[model samples]
Target: MPHVQPAAPAPAPPVAAVVVLAAGQGTRMRSSRPKVLHALGGRSMLGHVLAAAAPLGAGATVVVVGSGRDQVEQHLAQIAPTAVPVLQEEQLGSGHAAAVALAAVPDIEGAVLIVNGDSPLLTTRTLDALVAAHDAAGSVFTVLTAEVDDPTGLGRIVRDERGAPQAIIEERDATAEQRAIREVNAGVYVAAAGTLRRVLAGLATDNAQGEQYLTDALAPLVAAGAPTAAVVAEDPDDVLGCNDRRELAARRRTLNDRVLDELMRSGVTVVDPATTWVDVTVSVGPDAVLRPGTQLEGVTSIGAAAEVGPDTTLVDTEVGEGASVVRSHCLGAVIGPESTVGPFSYLRPGTRLAGDAKVGAFVEAKNVEVGEGSKVPHLSYVGDATIGRGANIGAATVFVNYDGVTKHRTTIGDHVRVGSDTMLVAPVTVGDGAYTAAGSVITSDVPPGAMAVARAPQRNVAGWVRRRRSGTPAAEAAAAAESRTAAPREDRSEPSRADSDS
Candidate 1:
């Protein structure tokens, strides 16, 4: 008997290769795009499956791509970051797909783990366990199977008296006795080198469907007295393959729910799971709270103790610890610790907020940075600019960072105070501790500690309102009234919803 070590702290040994059976016309999907190429959240369908197959630390990863071979190859190359693709030209059964995949995986001294690309929920941990279980038992071939409470449309596991070894009988080919069995083949397998190699070679297209049944190969392995056992996965749903839109939707929801659940489990608080959809790679630090209607996607990461959502959408954004991003749409941005963003703000790509920054309601920031303790609190567009620490930007402030042709930068130094409705034209600088008065359109730079006020002389129109009310000429009233209302309009409150019914 082989020597057995006490509970090992390390993970399982590496496998020979992972054979991904992805090739299928996927007729039920009914799309010009391959079913495997369909987008789930921000990633393609193949991406989810490839992610599952990765981290197994297998020697090689062979993907069987038939219908969308070229596209699959290209997508795998792009998104997988790493992982090799193999071609499966013909539309054949699972057995045939495995045969082609084996050709791609060179010299297999260890075990070959077969996984269906549609089974995206199967994690790398499961694959590792399946391989470990196979090798530990000294089985010639081992398949990842699951017991279904209601085993309809699934293959039944037929075991001997000792429940030691078994063969799988697909629902289509099984007899009445086999149909009553509860254990089903879950379409994931870990097979030994010599046994799997011979089985693939001997696979005949002698089934009722005129296709080589991979399940039938199990019978030959059993006949040869090579130990064959079913390593059942804890959850049967993980092995579910998507054939139609309904199945695909269910799978996508399941994966998303799992991602959300993991976040909650890791000390993050999610108010609602049904409406909140987060992508697979997203991370939420401990004590982070995501309220309802939050759709966080891409590689978004929310830091510790952060509060987000209640109708917020973020993509590819990194929010630092103690940050609060609420009711906003932020993308490709980074918010530092203790920053607060939006009741209705839009932080677009290249936006960065240093610690303790406040980007308040109705603000739009792009390619901009609000330094630590800086505040761009209301009704502002700060784009292509860098506002330094402890700066105060008053309401309706605008960084005129773009000309008609090229975009420019506006640099505001520390302790600067930009007054309401101030427009700082770019390639300009507001020096340290400078104060720009309200209503200034500053085209030139302001020196340190200086008070810059740029405006035309205020003309007194004392009788302006009297002229407008007491039947003055329409033209003059229009001009005078406009000037009178300008200041009030600049301080306008939030507009009421036009289509809102009382």
Candidate 2:
């Protein structure tokens, strides 16, 4: 009989309930929208916090909202439906906000993990590490701390004579000696739920700001002989919070750097990481080259060996393998393998370019599908149309897809040649191998192998100018003056005239 090994010990169950404090009216943001609702790296700031919290497998997650409760709650409902929202009627201190969120959580035997919603850079790994440390030490309270070069405006960690962390001192309430301390509170804590409720209930509004300071609970926990511990994060930036516009921009740059670094390390070549902004939700495949000034936003994906611009923005778009997109704006579009698009093109929603196709400079396409091996060169708008394989669309062709009342589509079959300055009105089709003469307005279908020309026959009157001057010397002189005024310009660079011109 084969010997069987015992199964490994089962993993411990989740022991914490999350409370995200987001109640303060972010006055520094100077917007009617709540600060936590501001977008960072494609999603809202609170969204990032919730994303980090998801991996914890916590018992419950509650968000405390104040001034813009309606807007924040509505947005949260879409992104994080499971996170319960509770209103904090007044703008109090961070401790007070956490208390409001905690009240929404069920009274259970576990730890309470309090986090700030504005700190988007906080990672789930760090929170997991904090929980692990708390469990190993068997402490009633664990405070996340970091040592920064500048601890201004942040709460400083107060230590006892033995150099063990004893309490946290807010910047405004700290003395000159206390201000010199480099270790600072990250405003994150995991405390025993029963003890936390008692601490919060006893908090008093007695500080200089006359607000209940969450850090105040640390001293009481230590005095009551309950074991307390502090875990310092390796990276100080990870705990930084966004309080104003300058800080918000700094946070965005930090997040962008993290995203670009991951992309480059994972086989994507980012030419200039400083100028390439990839949102959290964007994905790029291996060997893809992203040039400077490129922004890949919401749900955008680039395939292997693809090159995306020195100034391109793609949102909710997909670019296939070996394709090249240069200086273009594409939103909700798809480009097939080996396709070439734009030095200045705009591809709107529902636009699709098949394999080996080309959409050149100054072209705008919306709700259009260009078949494999087809080409739409320059200075054109092709909307609500389908162009078949091997079609050659000239420089100034337009698909008149809309009437005053409704929009319609035009279809051109394989091997069709659409001449320069051609207009294919809606509800029209050109059959395979059909051609449209230059400057024609095609209003009806053309059969296979046929050419459609919708213009009047040209009529030339020989010596018409001379006839107007045939009478006398005075008449010739007047006609000569008029002829000079009507003479063609010497500049050949002007745009070509339409066939309808006299």
Top candidate by lDDT: 2
Model 1 ranges off by over 4 Å: 1-13, 39-44, 458-502
Quote the positional error of residue 482 for candidate 1 in Å.
18
RMSD of each: 9.4, 7.9
Evaluate all candidate structures by whole-model CA lDDT and list the values in order: 0.85, 0.90
| Winning candidate number (TM-score) | 2
The lDDT, on a scale of 0 to 1, for candidate 1 is 0.85
Model 1 lDDT tens row, 173-258: 78999999888888888887667878988988877777876777888878888788778887777787788899879988988888
352 in model 2: Cα distance from truth in Å?
1.3
Worst 10 residues of 1 by lDDT: 487-496
Residue runs of model 2 more than 4 Å from their true location after superposition:
1-15, 161-163, 461-502
User: Which residue pairs show backbone clashes in model 1?
Assistant: none
lDDT of 1 at 161: 90
Deviation from native of the Cα of residue 350 in model 1, angstroms = 1.3
Question: How accurate locally is residue 315 in candidate 2, as Cα lDDT from 0 to 100?
Answer: 97
